[model samples]
Target chain A: MAQSSYGTENNNFGPGVAYSQLDAALLVYQEAGGRVSATEPTLDLSIHGADGRVLTGGLVADAVSGATPNGAVPSTVSQNFVTPLKARGSTASVTGASGGSTIIHLPPTPGQLATAALGRQYTVAPNTLPVDKGFRDHRGAITLGWSQPLGAISDVGFGGGFSRETDYQAISANAHIAQNLNSANTTVSLAVNSEFDSSSPFGGIPTPLTVMNAQWKTQASRNKSQLGFVLGVTQILSRRWLTQLNYSFDRQSGYQNDPYRVISVVDPSSGQPTSTLYESRPDNRQSQSVFWDNKLDLDPFVTDLALRYYKDSWGISSKTAELSERINFGTAFYLEPNARWYQQSAANFFHYYLVGGQPNPAFASSDTRLGSFTALTYGAKLGFALNGRSEVYVKGEYYQQTGNGHPADAIGQLRQQNLFAGTKAAMVFLGYSWDFH
Target chain B: MRRPLLIILMAGASISIAGCTAIGPKPWEKDLMARHEMLVDAYPLLIAADEHIYFSKEASSGGRGFAGGGCGCN
Candidate 1:
């Protein structure tokens, strides 16, 4: 929930604002033609399912005689307060009630799918962990830019902005120079840019004691760094079609390890378990990506497609292809159905469960996020252009990862293929865009 | 090693035959493409913001651009 002192007089203030802020707010909103953005900002306080059937997937081979399985109900977490903010011209306009579901995670651990009692399903109530997930309640990003003609088919731009949530915050500014040329009836353009990101690691497991224990222990810490240059292009194939190409390279050189992840190893001679903590790589890592996008106007509707090929030194490589068609049901509304396919090669140090796998002497922790896998993404978004000036768009996406697990992993139960686990996420964005001269 | 070669080849081939890929309003169409919401505008601010969020949280990229920076997220 966000609360605003400037617009307290009126409950919901859009372009219209209080007498003092009215001019500034409207001025900022008009500057870019205008843009408004806001995410879920949920305040759902319903008690999630914690009726005991939610078993903790610890695989202890022995739960204390009286210990009960507990994975469904997230730790004692509930948003007690919320301070949502509304902004214009990169400044806060209103701060709404903030307290709400921030990090909602669905249940079912990777290990629990097998070797567990099946009868528990009926007894387990639907567990809805309130979004006690991230470091902060609200996240917002704003950017303003300008481009001026430098030549027949060329333009230049300079701009910057800052964004932050609870655990992550970034301040970035960039400069780009572009060029375009006429090829018969076709048009081609290219650009080069530079930007940076300063961030901290609070995205993964929240609890240190729990998430990074046993074979796949991992911890996280704050990371601050600079992300360098990129080059891109755009092509206008014809009046009915358009295409674009962009490439970027980034190098994060700083602390690169989970301060919290840990693992247990057994002594060779003595069959006893000894725990070892894993840390980030001592050397800075590198990442590079290449992307291409095309949009074709099929009269009433538009078909858009994008393909990206990416690779990094961390033993991870991937290719992603996505397509979305925006169907206009007239000037009032549009519906977009999207489908995407992604396949990735595992990171060098990644392992399913590290107990009996090849250990990387160079890096301490395995990058589970980059395990070998193929994932399919499907979703839809409905957008309505309201009053010919404002718009509201809502989207829902369901993603499931299916891939072959490396046969050599010690913990075969956690393989990506056999142990199917997925996440469901939906976003509702209320945006107001107006073109002002 | 292989990636660098591919990138080099892509840049070389793209620039050498760059004329063949050209189309439409030339750089003149930038005014419309530069529009705040046009999918592939000359500006990097908004697209950068969106890509930043996507890279950190999700596993997809929506913008048509090249590689980005290195971080310790993985």
Candidate 2:
């Protein structure tokens, strides 16, 4: 990675308001349209038996370039946050499953699915986060799931999976029960999920809210646990219309901070960042979300609409809306167009920099993700089926993110610059699947 | 908040229980409902990959089901 010497030109770095040449250079660089891009290629394969049993697998490779978030504030004078970076990686997985009335001999109608799967993935995401940009991580996981019928009108299912990564490990389990009433015209479901995680960033952890120590001493790993529950209902409104509503609540405790992130220390009045310190976060978080999805079948055209509302304990809240339409060209080919809009509020303790004079808050971070932002995504998919047994599809999407750079408290030259100008990226996918007896 | 969530769940349950079969498709007219595309998650793998991408880039997660693999991304 080639880093320009933008910081070396400034020497009179001190407290209070001071001249900040770095900010001017940064605004110019951003105005010149410099950004990052990422690519992901994936291949999916599936085989099916006449008895409702299925086996599936896939491989995904990713190539990412341009600057990701570095926790440090963007140079007020030059291009710092948009670092020159690159990374490439891949993941592979396999799974076997059974569904519909595979177990019950009677009632050929669809029941549910039972599945078991094992997967492994390895990735080398280099030049991303500051901590050992050459970070290499791999993970392995296995899951088993089963759903059984309760008489003729209800069903119950449970599943669990354990995954271990080079530095992070997680174990999760879930159970759900559904009841079909009014002659199966309506279905109600309640489910619960729990996860236990152990994470240890590479190069060891650092003391929170402290200046970067050159020694980079090692610290013990941390643990976290999460529990969530969901309630959902689906209704067959008409012959061509269906709708679903779901509400979910989640609580997570223990280590909730990213070990690699840091907070920037800046001049109290000028808002010029002088140095960086490790970031810290609260140990617990709770959140809840509500989602609604609707689908309409209009002969050769199918349309889907979804909306979601979410809020968390960290004072972060978000809303998401998505729409997609599928145009079928007979039974052999189809084209689906999709669009999504998302907006979020910043965390309560989020800040671009910690002022030199003010007392440090209990927790603070400069990570861009913790700031208020809006994102828009547009994509489309085209699929082709070969003789009804095999299918191939291609999908492409473009995403743009914009942050609220100016806050009421922004000081000095900082008020003139768009610290969080914006980020743009695109992704493409090509996949194929086959079903055989 | 808890009371509101409980009320919403109860309302949904009540609606599901009160609905009648007369407004639904007949048993023999269930062909369209049984189609693969009619399933909520028609393309599981693609959806999974899409979820992973969003999870890594955004701060919010889990509108679908849980039990997903964890990552160091966020």
Query: What TM-score does chain A of each model score against the native chain A?
Result: 0.58, 0.73
lDDT measured at residue B20 in model 1 versus the true structure, 0 to 100: 51
- Return the number of clashes found in candidate 1: 56
Query: After superposing candidate 2, which stretches have Cα over 4 Å from the reference?
Result: A1-66, A77-142, A150-153, B2-6, B20-22, B67-69
B-chain TM-score, every candidate? 0.37, 0.74
DockQ of each: 0.24, 0.31
Worst 10 residues of 1 chain A by lDDT: A22-31
* Local distance difference test values of all predictions, in order: 0.41, 0.63
lDDT of 1 by residue, A1-437 (tens): 12333343332222222211100010001001111112322110111112211111100010001111111111112212111112111232223322222211123237422211111011211222212121223444444444455555345665554555443455555666656445423333444444444444433322322322212112333444645566655666655666766665666665544433333332333312233334335446666777777887775577878887777777667888888887888766888888878787766765333342345345434333445667666777676655433445555555555655335432322222222122223323233332221
When candidate 2 is compared with the true two-chain complex, its DockQ is: 0.31
